[model samples]
Target chain A: MSEFGSNSENGGRVLSFEREEKCHSAGCLELVVQGKATHYHGPRNVDSLLRAMGENSLYANVRINGDVLDRRDFENVSIKTDDTIDILYFMGGGACST
Target chain B: MFDLTDEEILRYSRHIILSEVGGTGQQKLKEARVLVVGAGGLGSPVLLYLAAAGVGRIGVIEDDVVDVTNLQRQVIHATADVDKPKVHSASETMKQINPLIEVDVYHERLTRDNIFPLLENYDIVVDGVDNFPTRYLINDACVMKKKFLVEGGILRFMGLIMSINGGETACYRCVFEEPPPPGTVPSCAEAGILGAVAGVVGTLQATEVLKIITGVGEPLFNRLLQFDAEGLRFHEVNARRNPKCPVCGENPTITELIEYAYTCETQAPGSS
Candidate 1:
């Protein structure tokens, strides 16, 4: 499995569609990513959203509308406009030991 | 019922005036026992505030001593305390703030053998340690003992705070599983943190402890609050308890506390 895939055996999978739909249209979906709202253009998935946020690793968990996104769905799961995505960066140093 | 004397009543009048923390809540604060794990930058504000707020018993565990350099952020210590043990200096300040409260000083580092005994009597554990190994040890110990822990971390201009109610809430392990590889993350010594940032994070930690003691506001349970002092932005992210968390999860793997190898630079003779 790729590094971006779930490490557990119970990992879920996202099936791909034959024809992709564009996320940018007259009625394009808007997403609140990391507290900032942005217009989402073409079939936005977790991977695309993460990329747009300059995040490359799947080590962090992505929450959509208060639910954790399954790692397997990163590439296939479609994100709708108005959805709130919160990316938790758990590794940043916060402990104050000097 | 915990009775407050005339002096006590006047001392904590501000807290008692709050509807959430009336006379009853003030009494609760007087009965709460909180153990703070560090006496440096973060521990300074935590100990001072807990003392000022009338936490009945506050135990501070710190093995280092005050240094002239520490005065930049370890506000609880003064130039006169430069050579004194951190816990001693901190406890002295705490008492000066509120002689009505009791301050216990432990001039020792937190290790696997002493952690449980040190924390067994306290109602809550506040993490102000600046290293990964000790941080992980505290998290695991808190989970094992089912003690509430208010954890905070600060680096450069960023800080994060979370509250863990034993194994019930999302634990430190539930989110990060393990500490990052040594050398991958910069220590405060290497990265340099703004002195005020420590106050921000440590003060938040003290607030969480007070909230836990009096049951006043919503604690940071099951949530991680991150703040960027430079950008002046705050964000809260949802964190769920992981059943696979080695320390708090069912069918657990970490049955006992295991001390991770310490790789940080050795502290100067009296530097925290």
Candidate 2:
């Protein structure tokens, strides 16, 4: 019973079956390829994912499987093959007209 | 006084046709007073819709002038508006959209000493600002004063929006409590934002405002909506009122407003 309700975790990414084994090198089929945004390597741990994506990790807010993960938890959280990660950072762009 | 004229009736005929927002809802829009802070990216679409929708009286506050860089994402200001004060450019454009609605402009900075008086006349507040300090300030002020606020943020392809009813719903601080300790805060660089991203989030904020004024549909309320444009997906998270929230919690530690200091820009590539 976490704060987040019954909504689909990992955003709306269709879960492509559960991972039976921890497959590291052979490439994970369900990787949410954030291409062009960063030189993304197949990230296993949160730090590697951030490093691969070239994200600063300072103010970047991370959420895995849709649950909000604190900055302190970044080092501890690992990525499974089926996991979906969303990193958000808030900025000041008032009047933010477009 | 909020009655619609023949022209006003004709103008909003489309809105009047919707069963959920007939003549009564249009009238609610006419009588509503909304104060929007920042005339930049997010404020652009919000001002356009609220004015076009015939929101009775709209107040816009801005201390920045229109720049060459802002013309791309800030749709309300024209290329000719480059050197002009943003409040003037925004108000002029809003008036052009709908002369029926009254627009009040404040060409000054919002500060701790002046925010209360600035918020005195408006019923609802909209946060279209681009910095972290002001966002936190606006959130805390609205929470302490018990005002209805529609919060929006966008960067690159990411967009976040939430509606706050002060102490009743979850405030911004309730979910993301870290405002950074003043001097300890480092400079945050801006990543280029897709111009359309602002439009997407700002339009949603405007929709929430219209919904709130008319009492139609579910107004985002305690739900945080995140839009990832790359995936074109919308994710929602339910947030209950945190009983342990510092400002709005049962115990309530923050009785007074606190102003945070930030170095350089807060985050993302946004112009205000």
Candidate 3:
């Protein structure tokens, strides 16, 4: 609704999930998960469970389980709305900085 | 009158066989002009393929010389060619690959002052440059000149190829926003790359060049093709033109070229 997708908010919890719940793009990810307070997700919030698993940025594909969740797939994806989101890591390295 | 002889027809028969590329594509390639910056790892295969693919006019801009270490991945230059100017060595090899193609060699580095005038003549620009400064410079120049740019980069075993059709597609800065500070990500010399990775990525770039000229299937405009050689997988990332990009934005901020020097104060391990 807010320029990303679907209807306006649709009024529900916006629980955000990334492998370790971190932000890889240096941008912020906000989740209204179940309409509680909007959970601010980024590199600064490193203690959360979603981020503890290193789910910040994925290479191959990321699947989310919930229908209400807003997922931004950076690369390739085959999202399943009915199940928990899965992250498939590819190119397990960084790009050249020179 | 770029007539295809019997041998020439046979050599390019596979290309002419495709409805997308046919005889018309062959002719386009013969008339196409390309400007290649940096004759290093990425440029090597790109130059080789573009030459062999029959791009009529190919220009190479490189200031560096061939070093012993560069031979590991810069395949165009031979061991005997080491210590020679890369533009000279690369031109020799490209001509050998296809004497029919014209090779314009720039013996000096591509700087802000020189890049504009140097690039104005070519139909397309291929960025095989290793540094961010040149990368950004080439992109901005292409956008300013309304030229197509085939950009590629390699780090370790992974690489990506994307073509910027200037006003038509998202520029490099649209996706990356800004380059990481120098040395934040290690160079191939520091990280070590799989030599063949250049061949893979550079070949893809050459394919893009051919596609652009031939008007073939799905050019990589507005999309980034990512390759992971170790995993043997390829993926395409959708890129959006940033309204905020300094070069091609609605209100561009970078009105001119700015030189940024990023070199280690201390000598690297294999520093000459």
Q: Give the candidate number with the greatest DockQ.
A: 2
Residue B2 in model 3: lDDT: 47
| Distance from true location, Cα of A69 in model 2, Å | 4.7
**Model 2 CA deviation exceeding 4 Å by range:** A1-56, A62-70, A76-88, A93-98, B180-189, B265-272
Residue B193 of model 1: what lDDT? 79
- TM accuracy, model 2: 0.80
Write the residue-wise lDDT of candidate 2 on A1-98 in tens digits.
01111123334221111222332334442344221111123545676666544455654566676566667767778876556566555544322212
Enumerate the candidates' DockQ scores in order.
0.12, 0.17, 0.09
Clashes of each: 8, 19, 19
Which stretches of model 3 miss by more than 4 angstroms?
A: A1-98, B1-7, B264-272
Q: What interface RMSD do all candidates show, one decimal each?
A: 8.9, 8.5, 10.9
Tens digits of per-residue lDDT for model 1, B80-118: 998899888888888888999988888988898999888
The reply for model 1, stretches above 4 Å from the true place, is: A1-31, A39-85, A90-98, B265-272
Could you tell me the lDDT of residue B142 within candidate 3?
A: 89
Better of 1 and 2 by DockQ: 2
Alpha-carbon local distance difference test for all models: 0.76, 0.73, 0.67
Instruction: Give residue B263's lDDT in candidate 2 (0 to 100).
Output: 49
Ranking by lDDT: 1, 2, 3
Worst 10 residues of 2 chain B by lDDT: B181-190
Q: What is the interface RMSD of candidate 2, in Å?
A: 8.5
Q: Give per-residue lDDT, candidate 2, residue B42.
A: 90
